[model samples]
Target chain A: MLNNSITAAMADIATAVKRYSLVGMLGWQDVRQRYRRSAVGPFWLTISMGVMIGTIGLVFGQIFNSPMKEFLPFLAAGMILWSFISTCVLEGCSSLIAAESIIKQLPIPLFVHILRTIWRNTLILAHNIVIFPLVLLAVQKPLGLEALWSIPGFALLVLNLAWISLILSLLCARYRDLPQIIASVLQIAFYLTPIMWLPSLLPGRAGTYLLDLNPIYHLLQIVRAPLLGQDVSTVSWCVAGGMALFGWCIAIIIYGLYKRRIAYWL
Target chain B: MACIEFNNACVDFPIYNASARSLKKRLIQVATGGKISSNEQGRVIVRALEDLTFSLNDGDRVGLLGHNGAGKSTLLRLLSGVYAPSAGTASISGEVASLIDISLGIDPEASGRENIFMRGILLGMTKSDIAEKLEEIIEFSELGDFIDMPVRTYSSGMHLRLAFAVSTTIRPEILIMDEWLSVGDEGFKHKAEARMNELVEATSILVIASHSRDLVLHTCNRVIWLEHGKIKMDSDPETVTRAYFGH
Candidate 1:
């Protein structure tokens, strides 16, 4: 039954987390290794964010004819969220391939590898978060403990990301080329998902419905809205919660059916 | 020292064709095979272990002598809990250190120092335990300055040294090895043999899957000769080895 599969998957996840602390370390190492031997380390992420927000704000502000003051903060917030979401989806697609050696050698929980991918990206996300506060302080924008709400908002984003990572890792493992396909699709998704510009600026009636229907768009809204001190919509909450549950269900079923075959597949 | 049991253990591997791994291809093969000839399934399911039952008690140094593809590695995997049996139980009472593949989990990109930690942890060594034996492991491996260099840069000999050092350091109650003794060079082999002897003396039970008759006689008092996934002979090393080799 569907209920039984969910229960089995939950049990597998718990077992995996307990058995593989190294998986978390592996994820952390990936992030460290990426920027290691470089002069600035993960500050590269922060630097990249600064460049993006500044360039996009200056260029797009004039094009959209929006005020510079309003546009810069909006662009900064949008860029930060886009970076978080894009990293989760992109790195997640390769989570399994990168951990192939570990998977073959030891039968630790597969989900641990997925968690490693998400956690590592979250670390980079932390470095990027530093830019938001510094920019706010420079502008003399009001920043308060209420900004802490973004913590829970970010946590939800992670939970959803973990679910996606699990499903994608399993899929790509079975089909060697799926990771590349997912990468190309993610590029397309960036333009579609309201990352670079506001969905409000889009021409129109049906486009709003498409944006509203996207769980990713809602996920970004949930976290981005709270971080930017905008009102959180009930619709966004329902969509995010719904996607979280649904994504987990799908991840679990795929993992349960395919977990045993993974060793052979490798 | 504890009891190890594999009760009615069975392992079924779902075999796929070499060309492509897809449902459509498999279906086409099945459909065509049925029309062309016999065994219409077109796919094969291999039973690596079938209703195998055995138990080993404390202080039993058992050698598994079998031809290649005779399910020796599969049996060791079941013992190590790497592959769970499909039909039955593989139960062990105490901590087991499996040298099934001596270099199984070493990260190639990591340095010798980092691999020492990774291998140590995979062998179930605690952080402090690894710390306690760090100097000794590095010294025995003779990897002096190479210890800090990445493993990808190490020669095969150096890689084997690091793997052998980490695995042999941990003395488990039950040790399972699958042709892992032959890791390093001639000089290192002597050192490895001595370490294996020490582990054999210290451990309560040791299961070795090897084709070497000399190794079987020297390391194990008991030997089990397996053929076609069944135990053909199980007795004293002298008796089983003679029967296995038919000499």
Candidate 2:
């Protein structure tokens, strides 16, 4: 029975992944639903983000004494990736709960809801992503072929986010208070994850290692470093990859044990 | 080939309030081996369905009759594969279309046509399948000019009509329904019931949970009467309805 449940859990994920088109359609609908009334529609995702980056870049560039050309592009990329990761984690908490009616009435795999959340945020990330290149063009920065590495880096980043979101969705559904705690934790993590500041500004070698220990820091570097035409540390890639593997394994086990109980819990 | 099987299947609802759902309290209990939250075992379990073991085959139209909280809806959910049993096993081997809440994923802000696509996919229809039937669904709903308009703009009757059309458009090997189709005015209700009968006839197995004694007696070959999460009587419709409705 134990082994059977595990197999079912794995099968459920496999089934949902194969129906990626369904997830894509639902995800697009979610994006459309949120900005339905606005004239710019979903493009507000890019405009609002541009305004925030412009304001923060101006103030923070002056405070850190970093050049606007360099700092703005850096902050833009970091904020884009960080927001994607954060919302994937935050909204994933309600992925199942928000679809309570569908989950109750339909027999679709539970994993499909998590994938929908991730796919929805991925669409938002695509919108916010426009800012990075525009900022780079504004500053007239040339990118090397090393930037192509960001492809694999971003893939790894999304894979890692998926597992973490899966865990949070399951736990949060059972524990009503978890979303509050998760929101607080993410709020704190934003300030600590080096999105607005440079790692070099930290005190010393101790600072780099501390950042190394933060998985979010490693996840950011793997994608950001490559996009910035810099070399991402092997340590960052390894950490991000390892987190994806182990996190998925743990997520599968937890899902296997509790997925059947999900309906009852709700 | 479609079959429904349940062996000692039981569904227990874990009733946990805000306090019991705290991870901090759960962690404390784990560490100290002592209760940190209220209630027995820090949770109350409501056994929604108990020891339900039965087998349904092709051509067996089963109707569930029960009072409120008597587990009719829970049994329908179990049959449709929404809620897996907490203990024992329940397996459904067929494509299941549970019309419990056909408007489950309909977005009010979306146009009537888009909501059709949304509800269609939610009922497990592929995009191409929905595309092929799109005209039929729209025509049946009779919201011609309003089809492109946002569902939020539609009146309450119009909204329900759209949902009913899109929901019934789905045809599955195993069909599950909460009640007889009764939507819109007398005119639309006639169309809805005709389409529902067509769907019921096409399915290999039918499971309808309803309070209407006459409808069950007319539509179902077999009836299962549940009382407080257990079967009170399960036999032919004529016999079960006679006992259940005191006819």
Candidate 1 lDDT by residue in tens digits, B170-235:
888888887647567888888888887887788898999988888888888898887888778889
DockQ value of candidate 1 = 0.28
Go through the candidates in order and give the clash count of each. Answer: 0, 0
Candidate 2 — which residues are off by over 4 angstroms?
A: B35-40
Clashing pairs in 2: none
lDDT of each: 0.77, 0.89
Q: TM-score for every candidate vs. truth?
A: 0.83, 0.96
Best of the candidates, TM-score: 2
Worst 10 residues of 1 chain B by lDDT: B34-43
lDDT of 2 by residue, A1-266 (tens): 67877898999999899777778879999899898888998788789889999999999999999988778888999998988988999999989898787788888888899999999998899888988888999999987899999999999988998888888988888888889998999998999888899887899876866597898999999999988888999899899999999998898898988888788777
Question: Which tens-of-lDDT digit does each residue in A145-224 have in candidate 1?
Answer: 66666677777888898888888877766666677777888788777787666666777786776587777788888887
